[model samples]
Target: MKTVVITGAASGMGLSATKLFLAKGWKVMMADFNQEAGKKTADELATRYSKKQVAFHKTNVADSSSVKELKNATAKFFGVADSIINNAGIFTKGALHEVSEENWDRIMAVDVKSIYLMTKYFVPDMIKQKAGTIVNTASISGLTGDYNMAAYNAAKGAVVNLVRAMA
Candidate 1:
């Protein structure tokens, strides 16, 4: 069976994708920073679809090492991943000049750096296998600037362009 690895798989769009994939008979490796939510989601999915079909790994997408570890764990659990969805991100809104450095960094780390880290570790395996797909989530705010959301807009804009560049 084909396997999919999805970052931020514990909730929102990621969680919805997980459910859809499971319903479609795909093996899913759910990665999220929220241990409780991740574990709960995994347990529920496993119960619904059998343990062999669903698994969860707690991962901090902003950390390169964490992302590498997640890739390794997924490989060990289900062999190389057939696809990856870089769906993890954070939205922090503030005026461009008013945003704190810490908040800006956090947004950038989660929204932009997460993709870099995941692709850094997972893309190589995909390339070696000679077939795989990557999907990244970006918001409409990225395409058009929004008021009082400069940081989020900037980070999402980067993601949108990055996705195009990857394609």
Candidate 2:
């Protein structure tokens, strides 16, 4: 069966995507920083689908070693991924001047650098395999600016352009 690694799989669209992929007969590796949510959701999904087809890994997508561990988990569970969904992101709402440097960095790390890190760690295998797909979950905010959402806008905007560059 085909396989997918979906970041942020603990909730929201990421969770939806995981269910959809599984229903479509794909093995899914659910990656999220929320260990409790991730494990619980994975266990629930396992009851509905084959347990072997779903695995959860606590991940800090912005960290290199954590991403490396994710890569290892992917290979250990499902081999080289057929697809990767870069859906993990965090939003900090504030005007640029009001946003804290820490908040800005967190947003950028999760929304932007995670994709870069995932690509850095995962793309080589995809390239060697000669067939793979990457789906980045960039928002409408990535396309248009939002009031009082400068950091998210900037971060997501970078995601939009980064996907374009990858394409």
Candidate 3:
């Protein structure tokens, strides 16, 4: 079975995608910041599928160290991921004046920089194997400005450009 790694796998798009991949018979490594939720989801999947088909790794996608550890653990568990879904993200709703520096930085780090970090650690394995795919989840707000969500718009806009550049 192909191995897939998904970040923010605890909920929303990430969670939905995880279920879809598992249903398709792919081995999945569910990575998320919420240890409890991540483990819970993994346990449920294990019960439905085989325990061997699912695993959870707690990760802070924005942190280089955490992401590196995720890479190491995933490699140990299932070898290099055949596909990586860089889907971890946060949304902040506010105009520029109302947005804090901390919020802006947080959103940018998680939504934008995580892609670079994931690719940095995972792409080499893909290159060695001569195959791989990277799917980046960007918001429609990234393509056009959204009301009262300046930081989100900015960060996701960067995501769009980054994906374009990667392509």
Candidate 4:
């Protein structure tokens, strides 16, 4: 069976993707920053499927060490991943000049750096196997300038280009 590793698997698009994959009979490692929510989602999926089909590991995708731990846990539980969904990201809203440095950093770390971290640890194994897919979620904001989401637009734009370059 194919196995997928998804960051931000506790909610939103990530959660929806998890359900779809499980329904298709794929094993999934759900990595999310919120431990309680991640575990709860995994538990519910586990019941609907099987315990072995779902696993949750609390992860801070912005941090290299945390991402490495997530990679290791996935390897231990489900072997090499066939796909990685870099779905963990944050949104920030402000005028270009009004965006604080801290908020800019936070948005970049979660939305852009997390993709780099995930790829750093997972891509080599994918190469070794001669197969794998990496999906980085981006928004329409990445395609056009927005009034109040400068940081979000910039970060997501980076992700769009990064994925294209990777391809």
Candidate 5:
């Protein structure tokens, strides 16, 4: 069976995708920073689908070591990944002048660096296998600026361009 690895798989779009993929008969490796949510989602999926088709790995995509471990774990669990969805992100809202450096860095780390880290580790495996797909989730806020969300908008804009660069 084909396997798909989805980051941020504990909630929102990532979680929804996990369910859809399982329903369609794909082995899904759910990666999320929230261990409780990730484990819960995995258990729920396993119960609904079957234990053989779902697995969960606690992952914090902003950290390089964590992303590397996630890649290794997924490879060990499923042999290879046919696709990856980089969907982990965090948003911070404030005026550009009012945004603290800490908040800026945090947003950039989660919303932008996470994608880079995931690609750094996973793309090599994908290339070696000679077949793979990657999907990155970016918001309209990234495409068009929004009030009081300068930092988030900038980070997500970076994501949009990064996806284009990867493509």
Candidate 6:
């Protein structure tokens, strides 16, 4: 069976992808920062898809060590992942003067740096196998500016271009 790592898999697009991958007969490692939600979702999915097909790992995508740990866990649980969906993201909107520096940094870290971290940690196995896929979820906000959302727009914009560069 194919293996996949999907960040933010507790909800939203990540959750949807988890379900779809399970339906397609792929083993899924569901990574999320929300431990309770992540565990609950994993348990429910396991009931539907069997425990062997679904597992959960709590992850903070903004942290390098956390991402590395996720990679380690994936390898231990299901061998090399055939794909990773970098779907974890947070949205914050504020005027340039109103946005805190910390908020700006967080936006960049979670939205952009997470992709870099995941690629750094997981792509090596793909290279060794001569096959892999990376899916970075970017928004229309990335292509167009938003009012009071400079930080979010900038981060997503970086993700957009980074996806291009990776391609």
lDDT of each: 0.94, 0.95, 0.95, 0.95, 0.91, 0.95
Greater TM-score among 2 and 5 belongs to 2
* Model 3 lDDT, residue 1, Cα: 93
* C-alpha RMSD of candidate 5: 0.9
Lowest-scoring 10 consecutive residues by lDDT in candidate 3?
A: 138-147
As a TM-score, model 4 comes out at 0.98
Q: TM-score of each candidate?
A: 0.98, 0.98, 0.98, 0.98, 0.97, 0.98
- Tens digit per residue, CA lDDT, model 4, 22-134: 99999999999999999998999999999999999999999999999999999999999999999988998999899999999999999999999999999999999999999
| lDDT, candidate 3, at 117 | 95
Clashes of each: 0, 0, 0, 0, 0, 0
Clashing pairs in 3: none
Across residues 8-49, which tens digit of lDDT does each residue of candidate 2 receive? 999999999999999999999999999999999999999999
lDDT of candidate model 3 versus the reference: 0.95
The CA lDDT at 85 in model 4 is 98
Summarize candidate 5's per-residue lDDT along 105-153 as a digit string, tens digits. Answer: 9889988999888888888878998999999989998899999999989
Off by over 4 Å in 1: none
* Residue range 36-115, candidate 1, lDDT tens digits: 99999899989989899999999999998899999999999999999999998888777999999999999999999998
**Model 6 residue 82 distance off true place after TM-score fit, in angstroms:** 0.3
Q: In model 5, which runs have C-alpha deviations exceeding 4 angstroms?
A: none
lDDT of 3 by residue, 1-167 (tens): 99999999999999999999999999999999999999998999999998779999999999999999999999999888999999999999899999988998999999999999999999999999999999999989999987899999999999999998999
Off by over 4 Å in 6: none
